[model samples]
Target: MKKIVVIALLIVITGYVFAAGKSEAGAGGAVEIKFAHYLAESHPAHDAALAFAKAVNERTDGIVTVTIFPNSMLGNSQELVEQTTNGALDLVIPTEPAIAKYVKKFNMVGAPFAFKDYAATDKLFAGDFIKWVTPDLEDVGLKYLARWEYGFRNYTTSVHQINTPADMQGLKIRTPPDFVNSATVKALGGVSQTIAFTELPMALKQGVVDGQENPIATILTNKMYETQKYLSMVNYTYNSTHLLMNIDKFKSLSAKQQKIILEEAEKAGLAMQKAVREKEADQIKELEAQGMEVAYPDTKPFITAAAPVYEELKAQVGEADFDYYMDLLGKSRR
Candidate 1:
């Protein structure tokens, strides 16, 4: 009788232990979030986004998981931005102009010749500017968690070597829908039109557009080299992406969980920045190998053409604010 009682108690305790373990494991094993961007899997930006997801998952011990939707799997950049604003998407990494729809101030970063180079670009993301930008993201239902550079913009075309502002005149250029970018092309005396990135190759082949600008990493990864004959090295504006999370979705996590996720996200962005700098030489080499006539153009003329934008920015935001952004621009050069 004593043996029977002991056996029954042992079985009951074992069952209870299994049940508790299962509950805990099931409850804390996964937190799924969507991260959207419009770059191919092989693109540096995509790789960086993946690195961010990997870093976050590792740091959080599988408690937080990100589902990266690259190649515009979720939708186009514009559609993704809309989803993010309406809370249909959890996170998105969009270009500077995309954010201008909601937070116009953020667009200041994209001014022509905005950053002198990568080091200055890093300063803008690291200092007081980030603090000011974060709240603006929240105002639009998104939270800016991190900023990462995608390198400087490089121009490419099949018919011409665009070494001067005059070379761009009368050229049909594919540009982002943002007025600022179109304004940029206008200032250069080019005809600017918005084209979806996925359809850009067709546009080029069909002569619907003359050329476009992108990072060398992007021009190579998308195989734009096949359609583009000229790769002009116009180190114009440095394009940076904002890693934004939907505020409501982020608020669903426990405070401790949120803190961990944010810390890990910063790590992911830093890793991406490192990847960009390190892989740049290889990326450029790949483009040149793929039959691209990579021209090292003097950007002085292009920079001069964009001088009018400073006056336009002043009109919209007043001289004081415009000057403030330009001050930031100068810092980027240093």
Candidate 2:
């Protein structure tokens, strides 16, 4: 009787230990990936993320599933990247400048007027840019997946219309905490004020800054039109959001799983680009209807004024990498 009781107790203890040791992969070995981004749910990026998640699930045959956290639910852009780097999160979508803080060469992407148009952007991305930058990301525990569109940034002001570089003088413009952004504003004669995106709407509403720059969709979706009275289609700099995954988390997947993720990421990124392009005209029209004045100043003067920014950036990002990027841009031009 004593032996029988001891055997039963041991069996219970063994079962409990096994249960506690089970991985978060859950039953049948399905892996759950956590993805977070700071874009609003109404934005095209959110839709693209959902499509990517769905495609991955189907392609992987349920072996992998993705869960999304939108609108800074997890944290702001920089915070999200930090979480991903530390393996606290599996994936994140952050702006190129945010990644530039970790990888200096990325600042080349912010070169004023680097891209002539959408076709040029397509060629740049389709070429060796990703291959060139992947190793830097891997060194920092990140895997570059794809580049999603953030569209060309434009200026919106409450105090004055920005028709030329001279018009920008002394105007306080809110910019992201990025050197290139601040440099661009300062080079064009505006006083650059650094602010986080999560705090921008309130900053604009409270008149913390006289004006700000963003894609039209952001202005419309975030209702910046309420606080801003003028919109200038400067198209000064094009920005893209990069999708990245934790390096270890990505490597742990099977070869086939890795292939599926890469393929789906590109497809979803294309979808996001398409959506933004399709909606841009209507978004501007809607903003106009909301009582905001729109300006289509000839960008030639603005581009010329921004020339010094390129040299400044080259000095910061190193001439070698900057020239390499310029070579790629030259090849990308049609």
lDDT winner:
2
- Top candidate on TM-score is 2
Off by over 4 Å in 1: 1-30, 316-320, 330-334
lDDT of each: 0.79, 0.89
* Candidate 2 C-alpha error for residue 167, in Å: 1.2
Q: What value of lDDT does candidate 1 attain over all alpha carbons? A: 0.79
lDDT of 1 by residue, 153-265 (tens): 87788778888889888998898777567778889988998998888889988989889888877787888888888888877766777788899878876666677668767
Cα lDDT, model 2, residue 223: 89
Q: Model 2, 102: alpha-carbon shift in Å?
A: 1.3
Extract clashing residue pairs from model 1: none
